[model samples]
Target: MTSPTRILILEDDDGLRTSLRLVLEDEGYAVFEASDAEKALLTVEDPGVDLMLVDLMLGGMDGFSFIARARPRTEAPIVVVSARDRTEDIVAALEAGADDYVTKPFSVEEVQARLRALLRRPTIGDAETEDADDDVLTLDSRTPLLFDAGAAVLRRGEEEVHLTQTEFRLLSVLAEHAGKVLTRTALLQHVWDQDYFGDERIVDVHVRRLRKKLEVDSANPQILVTVRGLGYRLDTA
Candidate 1:
């Protein structure tokens, strides 16, 4: 049988941390708790964690620093949960390798929803399709489409597209819904694993970054095309 998904919660407040643990555990997730960045790093080393929830303000080693250090250690999705709701904070978190951010006073239901959505997103180096035939796609057998249920490895023709985990997740989402118009809200929900409360420019930056790796011309992108006000889409065809 498959093991339950494990989630790491790094928060300093005892009450809030316990509350989140209870709420997430009740939602059928295997939740792990850490009160500071040091413990959080230890938890990340376990390799069992499937996702992470981090507080921007911690007792020591703030979220930004934790993110910078932890990003290289794990491929799991990281969501920043904090009282810092400023646009700069959000952007900085994203820039620092956070897949998403949630403000303080957030509902447990919202957290649960975001966690589920992020877990549903396809991992990197996974194939989008289930066909055993290799001819169905030309990309690596490991990652046939950007968001295939299997694993996905970003590629540009014969070259492998080396992307940060956040960038890989963003590209995977777009490639999964290829040819379909995905609104900024939808992208935020799926790729960033959060509500659409933050600036949409976050998506724009990541998309530009992704295009730079996948497209020959990032300015005039062909694969990752903008759909005007509708947001973006991948031209798989």
Candidate 2:
């Protein structure tokens, strides 16, 4: 029999933490719990750690710092779970290496769905498609997007443009349909999988994040452009 997928929950709130653990355990996932960043550090060393659910308000080290440190140690996807809904908080956590987030007041169903969505995302070093030459996406011959399937780094020329797992997945979709406008609904379905309970804003934030890293000029992007009332399309020109 295969061992259960392990999920580590790092949160300071006892009640919510327990509640999350119970719900996940009921779903047949083996869960490891920690009260703060310091404790969470130890769980990452375990090879069985399949994913992590973290809170930004963690007591000792705080979630942001934890994300920075833990990310380097583990390639497992990290999902930030917190009550903070500020766009800045969401963006910062993503920049800090979180694969996704869930605001507080979310249902256990939402948590389960997000976990499923994150897990469904391609693992590190996974090319967008098997036996496909489309892995390396480039534009303008000036800057090229190189995806090292073994390392999972999206590179421009020789420089590595670090991306969260979510960003990588989003870029992969855009690359597959380059020069074609994919609506927010299409993107959310392809990138987040079928069970994600998120809106177009999620798509928008990730695309903006991708532009900053993947484009030469994020303000007036040369590659990724928004079609008024339509969607986003990537054109090298």
Candidate 3:
């Protein structure tokens, strides 16, 4: 039988931690709790741990440090839970290697959905299927990007883009359908799984992250173009 999905919750708030555990356990996940970053670091040593839900404001060490430190130790996805919802906070967390972000006063349902989406995502090499047209695509009319499925590497100009699992999947889907506008609904269905609750903004966040690394200028992206109200298109022109 497949082992349970292990989830580590690092939150100083006792009440919120318990509440999150209860819901996660109800969904059949093996939940572990840590009240501080120090303890969370010890807990993260176990390679069996699958996912993490971390709060930025902890007792001792701040969340950013924990994320940067624990990231090297675990391939598990980290979902930052913070009261601060500023764009800088979100971007900082993402840059620190967080897979996703959740702000304070977030609905319990939303948190559960995000966890489900992360869990549903395929790990690096366990299960990655190829698209109908998995052939490498050219960028700028000269092959600058290379998708090596065997190595799970996406290289641009001799440098591999430091993309998380979710970012890689999203970019792959867009690249496969190069130049075609894909709606948010379609991206959610394709990348995050059809069961995702259509939180397309997650797509936007990840897309921005991808642009920062893949494009020369993320502010005015030339490759990944937004389609105003529709969605986005990958124009590697």
**Highest TM-score, which number?**
2
TM-score of 2: 0.83
Model 2: residue 234 alpha-carbon error in angstroms: 1.6
Query: Can you rank all candidates by TM-score, best first?
Result: 2, 3, 1
TM-score of each: 0.75, 0.83, 0.81
Q: Which lDDT value does model 2 have at 207?
A: 87
Clashing pairs in 2: 125-149
Q: Which residue runs does candidate 2 get wrong by more than 4 Å?
A: 125-128, 133-137, 141-143, 146-153, 158-162
- Residue ranges of candidate 3 with Cα displaced over 4 Å: 86-88, 126-132, 140-143, 149-151, 157-159, 198-201
Ranking by lDDT: 2, 3, 1
lDDT against the true structure, per candidate, is 0.75, 0.81, 0.80
lDDT of 2 at 68: 90
Tens digit of per-residue lDDT, candidate 3, span 1-237: 999999999999999999999999999999999998988899899644889999998877999999999888887889898898877777777777788788998999989888888887765564564423454544643448666544567788787766677777787788778889999889888887777764355677778878886666778877888999999998864
What lDDT is obtained when candidate 1 is compared to the true structure? Answer: 0.75
Model 1 per-residue lDDT tens digits across residues 1-237: 878899999999999999999988887889899998998899899755899999989877999999989988887888889999988888888777787778888998778877777777655545543331222132322333233324445444545556776686676566666679899888877775555455576787677767776666568776788988789988764
> Better model by TM-score, 1 or 2?
2
Q: Candidate 2's C-alpha lDDT?
A: 0.81
| Model 3 residue 19 CA deviation in Å | 3.0
- Tens-digit per-residue lDDT, 77-107, candidate 2: 8888889999888888877777778899888
lDDT (Cα, 0-100) at 13 in candidate 3: 94
Worst 10 residues of 1 by lDDT: 132-141
**Candidate 2 residue 152 C-alpha distance from true site, Å:** 5.9
